[model samples]
Target: MRDLQLYASEAQRYPPESVRNHMISNSIVPIARQFNEDMDALRGLLPTQTPCPLPARMAFVRNKKSLEGIIQRLDHRKIAATNIIARYNNGFHLLYLLANLSRLDGFRLHCNILSAADGIKALSVSQDALSQTLSRRHDALEAELQGQKAEVVEGLQYQGSKTSLALASLESRVHSQQQSLDELSSRMSSAVASPDVLGRMVRAELRQQLEPLLHRFADVSLLIDQIALGVSKKASEHSDFKTGGSGAIHGLSNPGSERRVIYTWVTTYRVRGSQDGYFRFRFVFMPRSWLCSTGISLVFSSGPDEFGHYSICPSILPIQIIPYSSPVWDIFERDDAFAVRQLVEHGKLGLRALTEFGQNLLRHAVHDNLPNICRYLLRDSGYGTLFLDDADMSMEIPWSLIADRSVEDDIESTREILQLLRAYSDSGDDSGNQSEWGWNNIFCSPCLSFEQKKSYGHLFLEFGATLRLFSWIRNDDMELNKSLLNFYLDTGGDPNQFAKTGIPPLLFALLLLSRGDIEPDISLVTILISAGADIYYIHDPDNDPDTARTTTDWAFALEVEDLWEAALEECGLDIASVYAESDRRLQDHRRLRGATRSGVDVESITEPGPSSELRRRAGQAGRRCEEGWIAE
Candidate 1:
């Protein structure tokens, strides 16, 4: 026992250096070697400067895999080293020095591991950034092409119209010349003194007049042919131009070039024609968030297939484009803050709305989970607050979409999202406006009935979510709403407060029992009374005919039971008048239900309303006196 105790006890004497050195060599040296290898590999993977677009896809993928492998391997090493340093004890005085050295080495390893992780993130952001750039270029080029195409179609129509008008004028001149010739022939025939001489005079005059007119007609026909040929040549040139046409407009011909056809004209060219068709410009991307709509889409449309209607379309361009060249979702998934920041800094993905506010890459972040990327976007990115874009689906917003969602972080991340919003609340936004994104209305969504929804509701309270609660129950939760109800009461929700809805605390409780019925849970009623609910509760929706129908309006009609009245009396308030009025209304079921019409007869005959088609057909067939009336 003494030998065992001595072995376990702390040794005051210094252990020999040789023994400690062997232990360190066996354990710590391998870890140090691995740390160096990982660091070297990571440094090699992340380039010193950001690639403009990105390297070839396969090369990028290879580097990405290498960086990720280093990160994972180093993470495992970090954890193993931490455990070793924590529990290391050989009970030798000299080994303390070794443990301390190992401790310092572990710190260095951790730092290297973090550095390697960041490189992985940069690689990802670069990839996403490149993809986004190419997509934007494609859209921009297509828009320019469409604009140029519209101009061509319009120019051709205008030139064709001028040609047609000239042809009409030439034909009119020919008809007038023929009329003059015929009239002269008639007069000559009537006034002739010599038949052979007169006949020769008429023939000579007709041929002379008709010759130049025919030539003029032939000239107009030739001009029409040239115009048609020009159109065909322009079409072939268009095919080639598009292949190399990235952003080059006006590739057709220089306006001042003498090479222009003597017959060609572009002086009156206007986009889509002044009187041509109009377009309702639409975007081609799925808007990603309320604070952003950064989608890369080509919302193409085919307009009226007529000449003047050939409106020139202009493609939309971004103001502050997202510059991330790679997909960095891996960074978000890891929740690595440093790596996320690297991506943000390197990619320059700040407050960019491809068009305007309430459209960005935020939806992508939330779709995965709450991560450091969201933090940079909401707090660090200078975006201020992510305002709700009404144009998007409600699921795009954090409050409505997340806590009730089936994400990995579940309720915890959902709360963090709300807290993030709280930190970035817009001072310019009106918190009192319950219909929008703010305190008064922190998403009373149907999705609020989620598992953690009751817990999620408390986040709103922490963030200063106000409730009119006529004194209680703010959560959409069925069971845990009691806590929220009390939260409202404790936080100064007025139990007797009546508003336009006319639902006081007392009647409001009864409405909670079910959808159109007024059955109050006694326990809940007592709780309301403790919170200072009015026992009388006189003025409700029942008093105002103009009031919109509400659940309280339905509840007040269910006759107040003697038990309820007695309970109120015990609380030192009389609801006798309320009971009597409710009883009177309840006696007449129709009156109690607030039936819109006085009679159930639908319309009371009203001088025999229009007959049903079936009934009309029956009457027409009525005892048809064997008449063909039935057949007719």
Candidate 2:
């Protein structure tokens, strides 16, 4: 009741618009009904005495019928009507006097009389009439000017000026426009006749030759778009793209230096036409973040007539135009060009309105293009090729596609393993003929490309190690594979060089063991153990741990727990017995070295002796020494 009294006092003192009367209700239905009733009563009392009541009032008045042919119309709502009534009631007498004076002014305007009311009213009436007439004339002039069109010329068109001296303005603006055009023309000419003309020509020829590549590129783009849409939808659902304060993950606008990447045109050209030909421009994306590697290149062709619309040229054709002699055409051919074409031509339905469509396309290309590219290198190219191409792709491609992915690093590591294999194979003269080489010699001679040798050595070692791991597990040649595993460990191959940032060889072996691909070869286990590979490195169940148990045999039978232990205990061949077997072979090596030093009978000592217990141990020790391993 006190609240009601205060509200009533407020409403009487202030216009309805100034006072917001609120009510509390027992229930929703009753409250709504009470509100309607109160609003109706307030609305009905508005026009009587409230029109000009307060300094601030909420009244909707439209000029329905003013002195000039204007009309005042007012909204007949409760608050608005009440406000109008209160304002009018407060100024009723003053308004009446003004109305009388207005009538005298109207009479004076026609009669030219000079009474007190007439003089003031006449001035107001004349000023209003003059202002209205001038405003109407200005509107008409503006409409006429807008309707006028400049005459079309056969050769040139002039830009009109706001001032009366339009011709002078046109001449001045034309000089600036011509200057810009001339500069651009000079650049285009210089680009055409560049010292690197061969490169430019090759790119052009490539565009024509690899017309199919462009199509494939388009197809790849579509696939990327589809994939991007999926990822974006998920990311967006999980995140926001709104622009806000810096580093606020919600908004994606400007993605800033961290998330946003800039793209530059790779090549630009103009195709001559009857009028103005199409301008073809190609953009290559480079992500700012050091983390992003794979970039994508896009071609956009537009015409003067098209204005904002541009024809997107998908992948350019595959051509060998670069300075490098060996072309990558074979690799691109092996990629799913047909599938890419299908994606661009027929797939990805509901993603037309996105401006970041190109970004999505690049993403799809990374997923689709990168794997295939890796496979080609693995099969036909060397590890070195992988490094060069991977670097190029990363540097040149758009990051938006693979911004969230780390698979490229794994691929790079794989390349490193392949390189290591080459090094291992090259270290020997047999050329992978022995059981030690594994069946196909995945890292053998075919990989010794001239270009590959020039590549980074560290990367090569990584590839060699990874490949060695894969081969070891795949062939399950445990006894024979021990040397390879030991080489990787002893050489200090990075233990954390895999996608999981851990040694992959161990995992591959363990996984193979788990799947029963091949029983952990006793010999392999022994070598790994001897080299200090953590056999007891138990893996968390959540994380895959592939480790084996092995102990080193440093010149002593007891120290070697793997192969040597089995031979000594299970085979009943004690250390003394093996030592006897290896004696003759050890003597032969000593004889050969002596003869070679003395420049006599080197060939005669080359023949090894028949197997003996002492000779076996000596031979084993000699082999270890040859491999740079000290037998303690």
Candidate 3:
């Protein structure tokens, strides 16, 4: 039973399915049962043999033949014993196989338990690391939320402060405006209380201010009227003197006795004809008053035997010579002549008027056959100084034409007529008190002192023709004057020659431009420039220092330079280049003049002098004349 218990314990150590059930059934189980049965039988037999002795059992196999039979039996018995032992060994081998299988199953179960334990330990470590990472993330999110909340709080505070400031400013402005409105209302109520008193006060103040001004204005007007009347009386006296009437007549009771009266015939040639057909002249003359209508008269004598005198008025001469509808007057009115024929025709009309008047006188002389009258008018009448009283008639007479027709037989009469006509035309009395003859007196008058004559002579020799041409320019004869200027320049007249007025021709032309009397003629300026007139030349300050003083007061140089630059541009010259070129040319010319005068005889040109200082002065005057210093 004990052995069976041990085997059952061993089998329980492993599951039944772990050990092979076939092995147990075929070998281990059967062997275990047979061994148990054999043990029981041996126990019964051993008790029976235990009563017998060991020598007595051996005596049964003693004799040889008997021994052989016995041996065979014994061999058979040995064979049987060996077979039992082999069967036991085979059963033991089955037990050993089942034990090994049980052990293998136990080892596999232990390995599986170790693997499950390792897996559980790794899962716990991973869980610990994940929890730490989640804790760190939670802390970071809390910090970020705190920062955002603080920034929101700061923004709200800033917005609240700005709103407070804006509201305060608006409230203050509203208060100021309300105060202004209240003050304006109070002032308006006060103004509305006394409207009539305010109006009267305003009106009284205005009248009080204006009364003295009105009285002063009336007094000034009365004074001005009295002054105007006196000025008119003086102006009339001056006009009488200018027009060759006797202003001394106002101081004289018998004004007609002061007049110097004479009579002459218009022609001296006698013709074979009847008694009296001649023009008689009468003259009562003042200085330069021969052409005055109040000082002269004309009469026609036409009768066979009786001397009948008919008066002719001098004022009716121009009306008869040029009727209102005449084309000659039209030429004067239009003031523009396109062709030479037009000018010639106009001049012919003037000549025709003088010629016809002379012819009429000649006819009356021939018809009267007045030999005694011709002699009395030419030699005995003493009327040679008398002139025609009409100024317009004298101007239109063409005195040169009349001189050309003078006869040797009537030479004295022709000379007397020409002298009177020239004196009448050239004197200032013909135009007005103001002389229209510019710079002519400097050359024509012979009564000047020697020094004055010398100074004027130089100017006249240098610029006489040009000055006369300028006179034509004043008469609206620009084309003729331009031609005359060109001719004078062609004949070696210096365009830069200064007049006695101490003004250059170009400066005079510029003065005319300033006066708006002439258009800016580029051609005329170019001609002057080409004839050696300096574009950049300024008048010497020593000659006319007043010009500089006036320029400073008026700032005239800027205006002059602007006009000059504009004129140069109109003439198609670049102003800067022209100015530079002109300065260069002037320098060259000055150098040339200085070099040429180095060996000149200074003493030969000066007057005979008593002292060194006078000689020096005369030398300086000669040099100044050579340098063209015209005296004003």
Candidate 4:
């Protein structure tokens, strides 16, 4: 039984699924059967099927003591039964404990195996994913490095190309420079080799050419000196001839034996719109055989078809003779008186009208054969100097304006005079040698020097007063404004006359802008410009002062003022607010003047006309005059 028990315990310890039922039957069934049999014995009971009478069974169990003993035995049997129950209960408890322990150990082993398998699978998957990720990253990095290397290579190639181009250009330039240097060296060598001989030849030629010119110049000088000396002697002897000429005819030659008239020419033209007429007198030459006397001749033609008849008047005269009296002189005096009166009664408006009238009068004079006469004289006599008797009145006339009839005419006359003088002075030049002379030399050579010339004794006061009037204008002495106006009106002083510095009255007014004491007078500017002072005249930059070097009107105004406010009140821009405003204002002023001359009411026009429009109108007017649509 012990062995069986040990075997059973071992079987329980190593219970395989195949023998589980056998182990349970062998270990527990017998113990359960013994416990059941013991309980039955303690009960001492039989089934009803057993054949026994009830009375017989009662008799056998009679007597209290005997019954008590039987009871005791039954009691023992119950105790034994209780013992067996206790053992069975304890054994069942032990078996249950062992089975639960076995189940718990199996469960632990299964859990450990599952956990390790899962762990291994997870590690393997993670490693594979990690390797794929690393490979992809490495490929991307390698591609990026390769792209970078290609870009670097391309950049290096581009830089190399640029460097090569630059080197080629440098080499080409160096070669060109070397060639230029070689050529320059060759030229320098040749120049140095023959410089002395070339210089000697040039000097010799120049000296040979200059010798004849010098000799001729000396002869001309001597002739001029002799003429001047003879004139001075005559002037000294006949002092009355110099002082007596208030009218044009004051120095008329008295018929005398000492003077003989050579050739004379005269003509008369009736003044348009007046009863007056201009009488012209011309003398060709005077002989020294007439004891230094001069001849005067008067001639007139009855018609253009008739031969002109001439009359000679022998006269003792100075070299400079006063002009003869004529209806033209009388007209000039009347014009002067009218101008003075109008200026006193009115103002600059009157002066402007007078200026226009004077210009008309000059145009008429020039048109009526005065230019022709002057041209003939200049061409016939190779001397530019001519003396008019009425010096005071003649000075008042704008002779320059008359002389500037047309640019072509003036140029032709100037050329002819120059050629004639050159021919006379250098008659021996058969070599056709050409030499140039300045305008000043040709025109001023025969005229007396400014210092050597005598003043108009009777006209000195008037000239001084006129000069004083100019001074007053310069000094802004408005107190004598009326006197100055009167003087200007009477004398018709040239407002556009150039000063020694070549500045005109308009430019002088501009210069006055810098003077703090004098207000910039727009009215003065207007007057000067209306009187024909050229506002747009540009001074030679080389000769002009630094301030006057500014060429435009607006630029000049800007230089005069540092601020706009100051510029507003000064710089002759009273009607202007800004630089552009001043420019428009000046343009308007010029347009207005030009339009008025064309009989247009410029104030009624809103738009300022262009400068070319005015010039066109002037050209049209000139054409009309030439066509005799309007009388000169």
Per-model TM against the reference:
0.32, 0.21, 0.24, 0.21
- Which candidate ranks first by lDDT, i.e. highest? 1
What candidate 2 gets wrong by more than 4 Å, as runs, is: 1-285, 288-339, 342-558, 561-563, 568-574, 580-598, 601-609, 612-632
Clashing pairs in 3: none
Say which candidate scores most in TM-score: 1
The C-alpha stretches of model 1 lying farther than 4 A from their native spots are 1-359, 363-371, 379-424, 427-459, 468-481, 497-502, 514-520, 535-556, 559-572, 575-632
Error of 1 at 337 (Å): 5.0
Tens digits of per-residue lDDT, candidate 1, 339-431, equal 766755786443343322223455556545565666766667655332222123211234333333442255566556666655544322222
Ten contiguous residues minimizing lDDT sum, candidate 4: 241-250
Query: 189-268 in candidate 2: lDDT tens per residue?
Result: 22223324443443453343323224423442333334334333333233322211112111212224343444444332
Instruction: Residues 301-320, candidate 3: write the lDDT tens digits.
Output: 23121233334444222212
Number of clashes recorded per candidate: 23, 74, 0, 7
Model 3 misplacement above 4 A: 1-481, 487-494, 497-500, 515-519, 540-563, 566-632
Q: What are the RMSDs of all candidates, in order?
A: 36.1, 29.0, 48.9, 45.9
Q: What is the lDDT of residue 380 in candidate 1?
A: 74
Global CA lDDT of candidate 2, please?
A: 0.35
